[model samples]
Target: MPSSLARCVLSCALSAAALAIPVMSAQSAAAEVVPMPPHEKTFASPDGPTFVVGSEGESINKVPPLNASGTVREVFISGSSYTRSDAPSGGTLAVGYHVGCAVELQGGNVGVGPNAYLNPGLLDQEDIGPVVSINVGPGSVSDVPLLTKEVVSGVPARIMMRDIHLVVNGCIGPAVVRQYTLMQLHTDSLDDIGVVYGDPLWI
Candidate 1:
């Protein structure tokens, strides 16, 4: 990593330092606290769901509440996810720090994030057809392959999916990136915003 890129990565982590308040160690959370990351941001496009960098505090935008009519795409955080104070409709939350991750939802079923589904962070969805991993930014590991439970709309990068494993542990090498490239995850289900499960080894 160049001096400039390394600084960016460190700055990203700084945003989420507060959310480290504490870790939720239960299989399911009763009154979940959706901690915000220090960093807040969006992807290249502004139409689709915003790609929140590191959500340090609650959400800044309250538009299109959670589980609304239109579908929502976000990386699934185990303990907490895109939600506010209580109830799913309050507001959306993301860890903000270390880059905001997301999951693709079918619109109505806006249940808790993957942390609501599985306990162990890294779920290995097997027998996948070959998940395509693309980087949208720094510190992203597009390893696990995923499929959407709903039909993804819009262009490839903006599309989201279901039935895919969202991995966060990312590593980079001098050989892989020849330029200043951001990683993105994509597959047949969607275009640029692809979902793929990654390996623990990447950690």
Candidate 2:
């Protein structure tokens, strides 16, 4: 073959090889790891001490069930809570996730006071831990606590959960979840409650 024809054939072969290789774009690379934004809340009191709670975490959703009947997720959460009170009775902080399937969780009410569901004595021993497994159906929600520990006066209490497995079943639709950090402080005069809620995750 002529020299010019040979060069053209070489160039065409190089172009074909380049087209066969796969390339990943920046957005596609970023979509692999989703990070939840950090959230925090502070509660102020006139007669008692002020309190604060914060949460930051991430979740990885496994391949969706082929039938869309359920979902499996791996979640990581870190929570920080503290109080300025020096109450003789002390205080406690709990951190966890609230998972819902086909249900709206935003603006949901969190009851306070003695009869509230989040009251110190209301949560059973089986509900608090570093690892938890939850299953909920449509229109229902579940709170899974990853950590619950005492908070000392003027000291910060930090808690974390790493790659904990969360499985949801019997869902007609998708699953959405969020992180919650609850703190209850017992003062000389009254009880103070502080709560922090993270952004929602749809998996």
Candidate 3:
């Protein structure tokens, strides 16, 4: 009888261990971190300077906020942008991200509410600074600037950003985010604007 009872206990323990395996695997999959592929683009104006921009980053989907229905994501994007002009003068370059949810942002339909106010002072800043967080609802979009600075001709400006903790409240479903680089070249004859866009990532 003693040997029989020991065998029974051993069988129950193995059964419990087997049941726990799937749960553990599910939890591990939920916390997985993924590295996004690097993206780059180049834009040139007619008889003007050429602008090149690139971004490399990674992202992780974290647990949602307490008592909230949305998800929280940790994202990091590093961008390098430069301008080349032979007209003796360079231009200003601005780098930022276009974050959206459930909307086709690539179709050029970014809906900003009437009450939304974008800080004008961001344009005047010469350093990479954090922009104010915007609450994006379903089917909405927001622009988050990571950095902006002046770029000299034939010189490159590198902006490194990491550990960006974004709490997307009230946002349901998957979210999409992409980086944009805009440069304004001031030449002797024409002041032209060039833009480069990074590949979109679904987070």
**Highest lDDT: which candidate?**
2
Candidate 2 lowest-lDDT run of ten: 105-114
Residue ranges of candidate 1 with Cα displaced over 4 Å: 1-37, 45-50, 57-118, 122-203
Q: For residues 1-203, what per-residue lDDT tens digits would candidate 3 score against the true structure? A: 56988999999999999999997777556554456566566666677556666555534344334343444443434335444444456777776777787643322211123333345324433333332334544356777664567777666665555443444444457777776767777778878776667767766
Q: Rank the candidates by lDDT, best first.
A: 2, 3, 1
lDDT of each: 0.25, 0.57, 0.57
Error of 1 at 67 (Å): 43
The sequence of per-residue lDDT tens digits that candidate 1 reaches over residues 55-77 is: 11222111221232222222322
Off by over 4 Å in 3: 1-29, 57-87, 103-132
lDDT of 2: 0.57
Better of 2 and 3 by lDDT: 2
Q: After superposition, how far is residue 192 of candidate 1 from its true place, in Å?
A: 4.0
**How many collisions per candidate?**
40, 0, 0
**Clash count (model 2, backbone only):** 0
lDDT of 2 by residue, 160-200 (tens): 55444445555556677787778888777878888888888
